[model samples]
Structures are given as structure tokens and as C-alpha cells.
Target: MKYDWILFDADETLFHFDAFRGMQVMFKRFGIDFTEKQYADYQLVNKPLWVDYQDGKISAEQLKVTRFQGWADKLNVTPKALNSAFLEAMADICTLLPGASELIEALTGQAKLGIITNGFTELQQIRLDRTGMSDYFEYVVISEEVGVAKPDGGIFAHAHQLMGNPCKSTVLMVGDNPHSDVLGGMNFGIDTCWLNTQAAQRPEGIAPSYEVSSLQQLQRILLA
Candidate 1:
């Protein structure tokens, strides 16, 4: 392997983060049918909140509570309660992305693995345990705990510290988000791989060390 430490982004990079499905499942428990229109409306609020969270403009708690506030009011529940329920629903439905298991297994002895995610702590651990992926990672750095999200070098620096300060060139950060995972790693002076599964155009002025359409392809590149 070319890298001694491999850091992965949790949502969509390794796990299937179907927020709409998770919300639907969560709302069902409260006797509410979450419709596509509602989901679309939710995204309008949720998406910007995530960007703010990533940019360090909002706290994780704020993002979580604010996004669910409308729904919480309608359901006559606290936003915190709704957020917890949503995370629970997400954990219940969490699954590894295609080829995630194979890739992680392949790199087990060759390199150390870690996860640096902007996702909430409430869901990450349980989801990893349920998917049998908890043992593979040596570190799981959550933005919620770190108080800094990806695209900021601070979170990556924290991850590097947890990794025992591996050589920058010998650590590779992989994720689906070009902005957060790719730019963050690059700015931190480490190698990065963008898992562009959707074949999205690269954002201007941000480039990754590598790009692949699938984890299988990334595995092949790493093991080549």
C-alpha cells in the first residue's frame, strides 16, 4: 500500500446515508407519514445547515435541532428528541456501501484505517457495530466531538494527532465530498482520494490526489 494511514469519510463514502429513508422511518414511529414533498422541504433546510456545520458557522447541536425544529413543532416534541429518533432510525437502516467491506478487509494488515466524519456521534458508532465495521478502524474522529468539521484543517490535524502523526504523504483521506474530504486533506498537506460515484464535476480550484468511481476501483489502485 502507498499509504500508512487511510482515513475515510463515513456517510456515502463507506456507508449508505439515506437521510430521506431514515426520516421516513423515524416519522413513522410518531404516526406521521413522511412524504417526498416533506423530504424536499426538509433538504432545503437541512442542506444549508450541513454546509454551515462544515464551515464552522454552526454548532452540531444547532444544526441538528434547527433542521428538525419545524417537524418537532408539528409533532409536539423537542427538536433534540426528534434528532435522536432520526439518528436511531438511521442506525437501524445503515449499510456499508458496495465494496466497502472488501476494501477495508484488503487494507487491514497493509495500512491503518481511521474515520473522520462530519456525521453525528449518535449514529456512527452503532451503525459501525451493526455493520460489523467497528473493528477495522483505529480512530473515529467525529466533527461533533472535535468541534470542527471537514474542509477545515483543524479536524484533519486532530485526526493526524490520533494517528500518531503519520507522514503527510503517507496518509490518504478518502470521501465522497470533494469540498470537505478532498480540499480538507489537501489543505492539511496529505494525499486524498475523491470517491466520485455520481461522476459529478470537480469544483473549481479544488483537486484531489486521485479519483475513482467506486471503492472496488480504489481497492484495485491501492493494491495494484
Candidate 2:
């Protein structure tokens, strides 16, 4: 492999993160039917909280709790309870992306693998375990635990430290989010691969070292 280490983002890069489905499952348990419009309303509050979280304006706990506070009030439950149920729902629904297993299997011996995720700590491990991906990665770095999200260099710095400070040139960070994953890796002085399966427009002021539509393509590029 061209890179000695390959780091991945957790949600949507390697596994499906169907937050709407997760929320529906979670709310069903509380006896409320979660509608698309409700989900849209939730996202209006939830998405900006995530942006604030990524921008270092709010802590993970605050984001998690605040996003669910409206529903929590309606359901007469604590925000933490709603959050935990949602994470549990997400974990139950997690699955590897197409070619995710093949890419990991192909890269196993060629390059050390790890995950550097801005995803929550609770959902990550259980999902990894369920998908039988726990043993494939050397490190599963969680921003919730690291106290910093991506696009900030600190989380990547923490991951690099855990990676034993490998030469920057020998590492690659692969993820779906351009700002956090691609730009963060670039700013951190490592190569990055953007998994642009959604085919979104490339944002200005950001460039990735590599871009591929699928993990299968990434496998070809890395092992070429």
C-alpha cells in the first residue's frame, strides 16, 4: 500500500448512519410516532447544534442532550434517556457500507487501520462489534472521548499520538465529510481521501489528496 496507515471516519464512510430511522425506532419505544416533518423539525435544532459542537462552541454532552430536549419534555423523559435510546437504536441498525469489508480486508495486512470519528462514543463500539469490525482497526478514536471534534487539529493530533506519531506522509484519512475529514486531515499535514458517494459539490477553500465514489475504488487506488 502507498500509505502505512489508513484512518477512517465512522458514520456513512464505513457504516450507514440513518439518524431518522434511529429516531423513529427510539420514539416508537416511548409510544410516539416520529414523522418526517418531526424529524425535519428535529434537524433544524439538531444540525446547528452539531455545527456548534464541531466549531467548539458546545460540548458533546450538551449537543446530545439539547437536541432531544423538546421531545424529552413532551415524553416526560430526561434528555439523556432519549439520547441513550437513540444511540441504542442507531447501534442496532448499523451496517457496513458496500465494499467496506472488502476494502478493510484488502488493507488489513498492507496498512495498519484505525478509525478517527467525530461520532459519539456510545454508538461507535457497539456498531463496530455488531459488524464484526472491532478487530480490524488498531485504534478507534472517538471525538467524544478525545474532547475535540475534527476540522480542529487536536482530535487528529490525539489520533496521531495513539498511532505513535507516524510520519505524516505515510498516513491517509478517509471520510465522507469534506470539511471535517478532508480538510481536517489536510490541515493536520496528512493525506486525505474524500469518499464522495453522495456526489456533493466540492466546497471552496478545501481540497482532498484523493477522491473516490466508493470504497471499492479506494481499494483500487491504495493497492494499485
Candidate 3:
């Protein structure tokens, strides 16, 4: 086989955190009552902060603590209380995406596998262990632990090194995000396969070498 490595992205790419449950449980811990609309509001407020954190503008501790703090601050709640509750809730939730296990099983022994995710090391590891996806990966690099996030060439370079530096052409980077996963792989000279689960249009200029709507599509591509 010409290719020796297959790098994956966590979160929606590998496992989808039932973040709604996480949020609801977290809120309940704080003694705050909220409807689904409020949970959606919390995500809207926190998501951009996470993106900024991934881009190096913030720290993991800040991400964990401040997202809830800021939200509570806006809602006139005690930020400290919310933070503690949020942590507890985040710790409690567990939801893996559809086909996650089957996809990992399908790839086993076919190529060297690893994870390159732009998330906190502790939380991301928890997700993997919780979802039983940890053993499948020989290398798992979280951006916060690595001190560099994806879409930054350094993280990809670091993941490549972790994978023992396979040929760029042969290595395939599969991710759900166009900017981070697709462009990041392009920067590393690795072929990218975008997983567009939502049926979003591929961005205007950037292109992935392969595009698949579901994890099952990967099986056909690999087999063929």
C-alpha cells in the first residue's frame, strides 16, 4: 500500500457530543432552569469563543471557565456557580455519532491511524475513552496539548511526525470542516477527504481530494 497513515478529526467528525444533553445537564447542576431555546442560545454564545480559542487567542482553562462565565454574566447569574455546574454537566454527557465505531473498525490494519483534533486534551480524551474510540488510534494529538491547533501547519506537521512521516500523497486526512481539516491537510501536502454530513456546499476555492457524505461512503472508497 502506498499510503501508510490516516488522520482523523474528533467531535462531529468522529463522535458527536450530545452537547444539548451536556448543556441541559450542566444547567441543571447550576440550578438554572432553561428551555431548548436557551440551550441553543448558550451554544451560539460559546461556539465562537471556542473557535477563537482554537485559533490561539485563548487558553483551554479560559475556554472551559469563561464560556460559562460569560454566558452567566450576560444572564445575571453567578459565573462561579455556573462554571462549576458546567464542568459537571460536560463531564456527564456522552454521545457518539452514527457509524463511528464501524468506520474505525473498517480502517483497522489497513493504515496507520491517528487523531488530530482542535480541542482540549482532557475533554477530548474523555470523549474518546467514553466512546470506546481510544484503542483504534496509536497517536492522538489534541491542539491544546500540542500548543498548536489545526489549520495551522505546525499541528499537522506534529501529527505527521507522530505517524512516522508517511508520503504526503498516500496519507489521507478526513475531517468535517473545510477550513481546518481540508485546508490544513492541503497545507501539509496530504490529500483531504471532506465529510460533509450536513450537505453543505464545498467552499468556493478550496477543494478536498475526496468528498463523502457519511462514514459508510468511506468503506466503498477504501474497498474500491
TM-score of each: 0.99, 0.99, 0.87
List, residue by residue over 52-108, the lDDT tens digit for candidate 3.
876778876677776677677766777656665554466567566677788789788
Candidate 1 per-residue lDDT over residues 94-201, each given as its tens digit: 999999999999999999999999999999999899999999999999999999999999999999998888779899999999999999999999999999999999
lDDT of 1 at 134: 91
Q: What is the C-alpha lDDT profile of model 2 across 131-222, one tens digit per residue? A: 99999999999999999999899999999999999999999999999999999999999999999998999999888999999999999999
Q: Which ten residues in a row have the lowest lDDT in candidate 2?
A: 23-32
When 1 and 3 are scored with TM-score, the better candidate is 1
- Record all residue pairs in model 3 with backbone atoms less than 3 Å apart, i.e. clashing: none
- The regions of model 3 sitting more than 4 angstroms off are 71-91
Q: What is the Cα-based lDDT of residue 111 in candidate 2?
A: 95
Q: What's the CA error at residue 164 for candidate 2, in Å?
A: 0.9
List lDDT for all candidates, in order. 0.95, 0.94, 0.79
Q: Considering only N, C-alpha and C atoms within 3 Å, which residue pairs clash in candidate 2?
A: none
Minimum summed lDDT over a 10-residue window in model 3 is located at 83-92
